[model samples]
Each structure stands twice: as C-alpha cells, then as structure tokens.
Target: MTSPAIPFVASSSYPVRAGNRVRPLIDGEPAFRRICQAIEMARESVQVTVTFMWAAFEMPDGRGSTLDVLDRAAARGVDVRLVFWRPDAETERHRRNAFWGSAAHVGLLEARRSAVKIRWDRAHPGFCQHQKSWLIDAGADGETAFVGGINLNPHSMVAPGHHGEGHNHDVYVELAGPSTVDVHHNFVQRWNEASERLAPDGRWGAGSETDLPFPTRIPAPCGGATVQVQRTIHAGRYCDGTAAPGGHAFDVARGERSVFDQYRAAIDAARRSIYIENQYLDVPDIVDCLHRALERGVDVVLLMPAEPDVTLPVSPERRAVLDSRARLGAFANFMLAGLAGLGADRRRKPVYVHDKLMLIDDAWATVGSCNLHRYSLFGNGEMNVSFAEPDTVRALRCELLHEHLGRDTAGLDDRAALELFRRIAKENRTKRDAEDPAWQGLAFELDAATHVG
Candidate 1:
C-alpha cells in the first residue's frame, strides 16, 4: 500500500521541501564510504562543512586521510571547499588538532596544491559551527547532498558490525532532488561569510579568490519523499541579521530553532510511539514533551552510550562528555539505557551510542547533527533532514534495532516494537548485573538516574 502523505509543514522555522530521495546511511563505514564515493562522482563541486577533523585520520581501506581524498577530487578539476570550525580559545585545546588552515595545516594543503580551498569559521565562542554536511554539484540534475552529525574523527571511523574503542554509531542521510538546493543555499551563505574572515596571509592560495554563487533556482525533483531542511542557528550568523532575500525563510538573526520546533511538534502529533537514539538527553522541553506523550500512552525508547566517551582512558577530552551526562541524568521521565559490548577479557564493555536520531509512529523520522541538548538545540549551528515517508522511517527503525539488539522487530507494530525493546532491555540489565555467561548484546537499562559517565 502507498503510504499516506506526511503533511510536512513550513513555518518561520522549517521550510517544506518535496521530491527528495533520502537514504539512511547507518554506521561510520557506510556513511563515510558513501560520502567519499559521492565526492568521487562529483562533476562540478564538493562542499563540506564539519565541526572538527583529524589530520592523521584515514578512511577505511587505507585511502590516506580525508584531505588526501579531497586532493584527488580536486586534481580532477572538482572545486573542493572545506569549512571547519575555528574553535574558540577555550575549545581549541580539546579539538583533535588546531583548526584547518593554520600554519602547520596550510603547509599540508600547499604541498598538495590541488584545487582545494579551506576557511575556518568562528562560532558563538560558547557554541560551535556543529553541522556536518556535504553538497555535490548543487543546481545540477544529478546533484546530491549529505547531512548528519557524523564528525571526521577517528572514533567515527569504525565499520558497521564491528566494535571497539573509538567505535561510534552514527547516521548520515544521502539526499537528492529539490532538497539539495536547500543544502546548496546553506553552503553558499556560510562560505561567502567565512571567506570574508580569511586572511590575506597566503592561507587560501588562489582558490579562495572567488566565491561560489548562491543557487538561483531549486533543483528538479528526484524522488517521491517529502522533506524539510531544518536547522538550529544562533542569531547573526547569516544574512547580516536579516531574513534571507529569496527561496529561504530562515533569519538566523532571530535565532532560528527549527530542529527543536520540529521535534516538539512531531512528538505532540505522535499517536503510537517515539524512538530516539541520541548522545545526550538534557533538554528540559523535550523531556517534558516526552512525559506528556507517555501520559497519552505513547511508548518512548531512547538509546545512549553505556559509558561516557570522555571517560575513556586515552580520551583527551572529558569535561564536555562528563558535563553532558550529568545533565541527562536529571530527566525523570526518561529510562535511559546504555549500550554494552563484550570486552576481550570476556566481560561486558560499554558501547558508545553517538547517533542523533528520532522516529514517530513509524510515519515521521529525522537524522542529523542536532542532539537533544541545550547547546545543540539552541546555540550550535546544526542541520537535520526530516522526512514524513512511512516506509523509510519504519525501515530505519528496524535497521537500528537489528544492529543494536541483534534481532529484528519481526513485523511488530510501532508500539509493540517499542515494548519489545523495553522487555529485552530490562532482561539485558538483569543479566548484566548477574554476570551471566551469555552475550549481552547492546541494550542495558539503568535502574536509577545515576549516570555511567
């Protein structure tokens, strides 16, 4: 049967878009693998905006590093542009390396001498330019884009069906059709502004001499799904604190919170269940809405990391992870569960859940960089692609559950599937405490609000 139309709404926050082909790329291996492939297939341009990237990190299959891949693409005449977060003084020490285009970083780019150019943008000092996105040949018939929270860090390089330290579970949506125009719009806005901040210190070389043009017309439709390109952007980041001229309704000067608006509205409209997999659950508004949904008999299931990523022995950063965990533990309505995997010593090891995802009633879904945390929902520059396609949402839910629980929902309805997860998670928690010999898989429910971070 054909699924009902999603009734996607556009307002001051989210603008409605249609005819987008959205595919959920689960785990780092598939997400990065597909992203690299799309970059390779680009005929005109490749634009990437990410929070942080490691200089030494390499793609799976020994492809050197992300820069190496971009260099290869640039050598073939593709205009490769990189926009990386220029971490504030306080945050700089925590990033994998100094921001891109630094003295040392520029030397690497100069050595390649490819068509690649880069710029570093400073966020709200307290927040970050946290969106992870890629746009390929926007405004063209075959244009495509990707959006999600997967960073270019080593912890996010793990393959699907594999487990270890630095193993992070994440998702990125591969997008085609009219929605790619919106992605293109966003890139042009950031790139033009970031270019202004670039110094004449020979960092950008000749590649930064010209600015990419704003998408004049929306791309032709590519598929059947309805989509809304949403974001959380702090005020004054774009458009000189004014509403964008045309084809976009967002005014970052007013502090657009489309992602938060969408989540609350979707929860309010949910009739059966809401499934979420996020790194943090510290937002009070979201927690309150979930409590109300639970009162209306809505089933809520959330997946988070069993142990804080910051708490890892070799992890250089701890304050952010530890701080976020403390706030998440305050949610009264959330029965948070930490995922676990088996250690080499035959003991249960904590599996980190880093994906930001949400599904409602098997009819609506979202996957992207915005976490259910204050910084992400309010202050950070973030982006997410939401769809009202029932088939895609249900399939994504099943895929996530199968990966984590080692079993499928087996044709259960949304509510029943959520209940099954509750039952299995409770059983897993009991087994974990008893030190049972059987494989514990991933889900382990918490008995109290106390956090494991």
Candidate 2:
C-alpha cells in the first residue's frame, strides 16, 4: 500500500509559501552534501551566516573545509561573504584556548584577507546573532537559499563522540525561485548592518563594485518558488545610542511582535495537530498553549534530545525548568487519559509532544535557532523560518511521529501509542533507583533542592 503523495500549497494562502518541486533530504549528512554541491556550482555569489564556523570542518567527501569552499568560489570570481557571531574581544582568548582549542582562527583570518569578506556580528552583550542560513547563485542559471538549524561548524557535521562532536540535531531548507531573491535581500540587509558596526565611522558598511569578482546583480531566472523571512531580537539601543553595533544589528523587540507571541498564536490556532522537534522543550507559555490545544481536541507531538549537551553541574534555574517540564508532561498525560474515549478520536490514542520542532495542521512548520524555552523566545537573539507548504508540512509531521512510536527510531509521533510511552517516561522520572534494561541511561533526573522562584 503506497502512501498518498503529499500536497503542496501556495504562500499567499499561508503565512509562508512552499515550493512544488522540493524533495525531502533526511539527515545532516545528505543536507550538507547538497549545500556543498550548490556552493561548488555557484557562478556569481555565496553568502553564509551562522552562529559558529570552524576552519577545519569538512564535508563527508573530506575534500575541503567550509571556508576552503568559500575561498574557492571567491578565487573563481564568485562574491563570497561570511558573517558569524563575534565573540567578545576580552573573552576571545579564553574561548579559543578552552572551548575551541584546535580552531584555526588565524587561518580563517588569512583566508578573509585573500578572497572572503568575513564580518563578525557584535550585537548584544550576552545575546548572539544565532541565525544559520546560506544564499548562493548557482551559476547564471539560478540561485539557492538554505535556512534552518544547521551551523557551518565541525561539531554540527561530525557524528557524536568524535573529537569535535556536538550532540545536536538540526534541519535546513534549500529553496530556489523568487524566494531566493528575498533571501538574498535578507543577507544584504544583515551584511550592511554588520559592516557598518565594524567600520571606524560607526555606521553601516558599504560595499564597492570591485570588492569581488562576480557581478553585483545576479539576474533572477523565470519560474522559481517564492520565500519569506522572519526574525526575532531584543529591544534596546546599541552602545548606549553612541555607536552602532557591528554585524547585523537590529532592534528585535521593536521590529515586530515577539516570536513567542507568534508561536502562542500558532499553537492556539492549530485545528488538527501540532508537531515539534527541538533541543529544549521547557517553555511554560508554550506548554500552556499545548494544554489548551489538548483540551480543545488538537493533537500535539514533540521530539527532543534524549540527553542535553549541558552536562555540567546543574544550576537552580535549569533544574526549575526541568521540574516544570516533568510536571507539564504528567498533566498532559492525565488529561489525555481522561479524554481517551471521546469523539471520533482519529487524532491518535495519546497526546504526543517532543522538543526539536513544531508542525501545525500539516499546513505550517517552523525550524530554526529558537527552542521551546523562555531564553529563545524572549531572552536570546534567535531566528527561524515558518514554512507553509502542504507537502513539506506533512512530510515533517510523518517523520517526527514515526520516531515517537518506535516504528522508526529516526522519527517520532506525538500522539501514536503515546500513553504507554508516557507511563514509561513517568516511571523513569519517579523511580530513580530502579534500573530497567530497556532504559538508554540518558534520561534527565531533576534534583529536589531547586526552587521554582
């Protein structure tokens, strides 16, 4: 029995549009391969913005570093601009020596001097410029834009437990069409903003025609898809309103309504189902919204990392979040158990939810740096692209739910066979001393000394 082919919808009907000819590329490995291929094929320009970039990171082919690929594009006369979160100069040596011991900052610096235009986004004090995206002109024929959670760093690419492995999971979308133009416009906006702050003049940076080898205006080919860009930031004046901050600085709070607010609305508006995948699943407001959705008969599912990367001594604040989430999960299970026999209930047996992502109605999706937590919603600077293609939405929904049910370890479902799993999860939380053979030994244990306040 073959599954029905997923449908694709237009952007105008949805807040974000989806392309008709897009295909799903599973896992970071294949995704990176596509990006490398696109970069190699680029004829005019390539613009990359990420939270972090390591000079030694390589593709699966082991051919070159991400920086090396950019340099090659530049040597071939392709305009290559790289922007990343600028670490504080005061703390730079400490981070380089401790966290990134093997980093080649000097090599990257020399590469910039030759062909690449590298800029650091020195935005807020504790906040970071946490957007990960790439825009490349794939020859004079067309352009491609990638937006999602993957960073251009070694940890992001390497498998877990390797020398520089980051136990993280992420997604990126490769888009072509009129949407590519919009993505390019976003890159130019950030580039100018970042450049201005770096300049001695304390204003946005300006680029000249001779800055690179490729023509500045890469003409758009006919008959491609359309794309939309959305972002979030903190509200404040830079340098006490005295000097502009370098690298993609913007008044995030003032630019639009809070990203959290948008997420709340989407969760509330969900008619059929909501699916999420993330690193942290600890946001209270989002949990409240999900509770409400469950009450109204909307199905919710989430996929989260079995283990958090922050394995250091747990802070009181972090513990409070864990406790809150555990309690929330318990409440969700209790509610679903009571409502198990209600209505037609084609909505799956149990209410399922996880951390990595959120899909609504199989019509809308969001993938990016923001987690389902307060820091990502209101504290840290984060960016995510909300997608509205029917096919994309449905496919993501299936992948996540599939993982949840144990039918596929690679995918998880929010509602399918959730009650049994919830009971198991509850047992794990309650019985710390009891070791089960099936347990992966990766579940988090919240300490009792932490206070919510």
For candidate 1, the lDDT comes to 0.75
User: Backbone clashes in each candidate structure, one number apiece?
Assistant: 0, 36
Q: Which parts of model 2 are misplaced by more than 4 Å?
A: 1-25, 89-104, 111-113, 138-141, 158-166, 195-227, 236-253, 311-324, 331-356, 400-453
Top TM-score prediction, candidate number? 1
Candidate 2 at 354: error in angstroms? Answer: 12
lDDT of 2 by residue, 13-123 (tens): 112333422334434666688888888888888888766665567776875877667778888988777666664554363244221212356444444665666665554
Error of 2 at 323 (Å): 4.4
Q: How far does residue 123 in candidate 2 sit from its true spot (Å)? A: 1.8
How high is the lDDT of residue 338 in model 1? Answer: 68
